[model samples]
Target chain A: MPLSKAQLLAWLGKLDAVYAAKKEYLTDLDAAIGDADHGINMNRGFGKVMEKLPPVADKDIGTILKTVGMTLMSSVGGASGPLYGTFWMKPGMLLGGKEELDAADFARFVEAGVDGILQRGRPERGDKTMYDVWAPVLEVVKARAAAGDDVAAIVDAALPVGEKALADTIPLQARKGRASYLGERSVGHQDPGATSSYYMLETLRDVLHA
Target chain B: MKKLINAVENVVKEQLEGMALAHPELTVAFEPTFIRRADAPVAGKVALISGGGSGHEPMHGGFVGKGMLDGACPGEVFTSPTPDQMYACAKAVDGGAGVLFIVKNYTGDVMNFEAAAELVAADGIKVQNILIDDDVAVKDSLYTAGRRGVGTTVLAEKIVGAAAEAGYDLDACAALCRKVNQYGRSFGVALTSCTVPAAGKPTFDLGEGEVEMGIGIHGEPGTHRMPIGPVDALTAYAAGQIIDDPAYTRTVREWDGSGWAENTLTDAPFAKGDNVIAFVNSMGGTPLSELYAVYRKLDAVCKEKGLTIVRNLIGPYITSLEMQGFSITLLKADDEILKYWDAPVKTPGLVR
Candidate 1:
């Protein structure tokens, strides 16, 4: 029922691989409504995080996460840099010195990450941004955690919700970020940030199963 | 993707290297790339900093030197620089007087600069971020990212950078920059979309005779597209937006030494008999002859409207990396602005 730092490191490594394999696909999705570098930038950021993660693998979860945050902030050059970097950095700060995380800690971690993103980007649900996924996905995460699920079940439960949220990004007009430049034309394209968010949760689910 | 570079990833690095080699007065630092004046941290003077995506060459970087930006942070192609770069650049150039950040209104640039401002202030350096939203095409900020900062940024940098060089305090320089921005309006049209090296293709597609109106620097799909028209008609259309724009009221956030302060500002419409600086800027691909042609039409329109082009900048001052387009910026220059504009500058892009 507990997720160890080892598993967290493995999850990060898996994320590095997943982003590397799917970088072009992500960029393709972004090409529809936004600039087509979401995948490349994410891959580059996570790749750097992976290279930096090894030295801190023995540290507490918070330290590991903060390292990833700093790596992404410096390596990534787009809105994703600060957004995803904050997502990790906030959870890491809250979970400092912890050797492992239980369901409550994991739920609070996701919640803190979402709150950090909200504070940084100021986006609301249906803005056709990553927030569109985070709002509903957080609801799912909180419900699963409250129901006494472990990190695996909580993340497993949240994966489909995140994917659906990604799909739902279609038909929504963007009101934030570069996609807003397209206005009504931004509809019918899956938000790239939402897609990456889905991938992130999906990576966690795969880590749990492994 | 036929480019002059030997490799795509090395574009920014090689450019920085070339800049450092060519200009002995500038210092280009990699590993979180930033370009600062070789004589940075000029004591007793306010330090000016500005940057954005790298593709808009000769902008934040080329303008970094004697009478312009004290430092600049260049990001990936058409992408905003990260906060750490800005923070490092600010720390490298901050005089005891303070530092002023000239930021474009794009979401990434605004967020990055805001984050950097907080980080820099925590390190005990005074910081103020002045937003430039002079592009009049977006129409509304409630639903959009305000107006995209374009040609007006060029004018702001030159004007405010001179003020800083002339010993204005941080608050006074920020006020002058804000005034310059409020009085400036810009509009641009694109004959072709720019091809980012990373994207490996044009940002958007255009037909043989199609043209995009109200195009932003990043090749975002524009307000409208129409059949290609004569240069005179096209220039007139873009000029009309800047000239006839009604008073626009918007709220922007400013850093007031301690925390963020929200200031609601309004821009008055351009009136007759105004003395102005008419800037005709290329989007990088257009040659000077075409720019002059656009300016030729812009001059006629201003004359008919009773506006005088007392000074003008005609060239690829703020470009979109070989995107075949041009933008026009007109600022009602007061005596202070004109005097500062005529101040001695020795940047790679501008020399006076």
Candidate 2:
């Protein structure tokens, strides 16, 4: 099944709630490696998104997504600001005028979002960044879409892999962002960016299930 | 947990309001927050804009005034301001000569400034970026996200701002700024961790005697740590590392007219008889008396190494909130740099 504009808004709200609940946990993880503001930054960004979202809730998914992107870009303010901000803005621009996203369209949307991050952040996968989680989840989505799976099934299958990918970041030494400063010390801490990316994917899965 | 704040969310805005009330020379804009010189759009001069997180007071914002920064964007505490703030500031301050962006080498600052530059350029305004990455604590780009731009940022802003006011065009100002970055080296030591108001507690804990060495300006842990040492020992350790450090090489991104351009730059090691400006900066909570003590040691080390301190500045100019710490910066000064550094200018944070 494809997701409507309402479902998409719900996904955003769900993501906001997830960040709200997990902000401190994410911050604790970030404190281990980063400057220790990931949770606060994410909550501030998503909280702004929730506030600005009401006015555009009736808008098309592309317009709605663009609004969220701009809000995140302005409010988030760290590496994540431009990284995740562009992630939404790119797909919002690409998926313009679309009423809803089917499984294949969703896969393409994810690719465009990742492309935005790649261009802005210039980070490679396995750098213990958000790209690590996004890259693995993207691969599964692409394969599932190519195999003709629907959005619901593809999301369900990808959630576990994305979680594993997030877990996998614990052992990888950071090579990007502020956490990269820790070098070997970064190895044992779960990557904050990766965890946030997993939360994003899990939001997608739960939205689909509901 | 104690801070003189109204609320966590309102801290930045209220602080900006306080700045506006105190400094009438600055025009504070809220909504899309930005602070610019009241007499901005100084006709025929290239405006210089820079900003980073809020806790570093007297930085990009407090420095915004005549012959210093034309404008500064302040983000939430310890957060880089958004691109829209930069874009708006650029357009508001451009004097038809162009605008030069003085960016610190943090990933967030770089990305947001890049986006703002693109936005302004698409609107037909010329903008150039000079990235400042001068921390010598982090060894190389391999282990860290590259060296963090620390105390040298303040010196760069003052020097580059004077150049811009003296009719050096955008390109010339950028060149001078980059030269400053290349010639500058900084080493920081944190005696105690700082609390970002939103975080509600110290970023990190130090046992009774533990101290963080080589720390970045954002209260982030340094490259190493050791038990607390005497003031002279801590000062010597930081200065020794900087004075004896090897050459540092890195590739950084800057903007040409059309696209992002990469420049490979190097930090030449300082040697005997090298004329330089020595700066001892506090990370905030440290007192002026302590900084002078630090300067006392630094001056002796420079003299012993035969490195001439042609000029010296000490105090809490570029701070990282109320963190009890210090960073030493040494910038190799040439004739041009010396001339600009001594130029008369006025700003809230710096006056001579």
| Residue-by-residue lDDT tens digits, candidate 2, A1-210 | 787787788899999999999989988898888877899899989999999998888778789878988999888888999889999998999888889998888998899999989988888878999998888889999999899899888888889989998888889999888888878888888898889988988887888788
Instruction: Give a tens-digit lDDT track for model 2, residues B265-333.
Output: 888899888999999998899999999999998988888888999999998988888989899999999
State, as a TM-score between 0 and 1, how close model 1 is to the true structure.
0.97
How much lDDT does candidate 1 score?
Answer: 0.90
What's the C-alpha lDDT at position B120 in model 2? 88
User: What does candidate 1's lDDT look like per residue over B1-352, in tens digits?
Assistant: 8888868888888988998999989999988789999999899889999989999888989999888899999998898899999999998998898899999998888888888898999999999999999989898877766888889999999999999999899999999999999999999899988888877888889998999999888898889999999999999999999999999888888998888888999999999999999999999999999999998999999999989999999999888888898999999999999999999999999999
Residue pairs with clashing backbones, model 1 = none
Q: How high is each candidate's TM-score?
A: 0.97, 0.96
A146-184, model 1: which lDDT tens digit per residue?
999989999888888888888998999998888887888
Worst 10 residues of 1 chain A by lDDT: A72-81
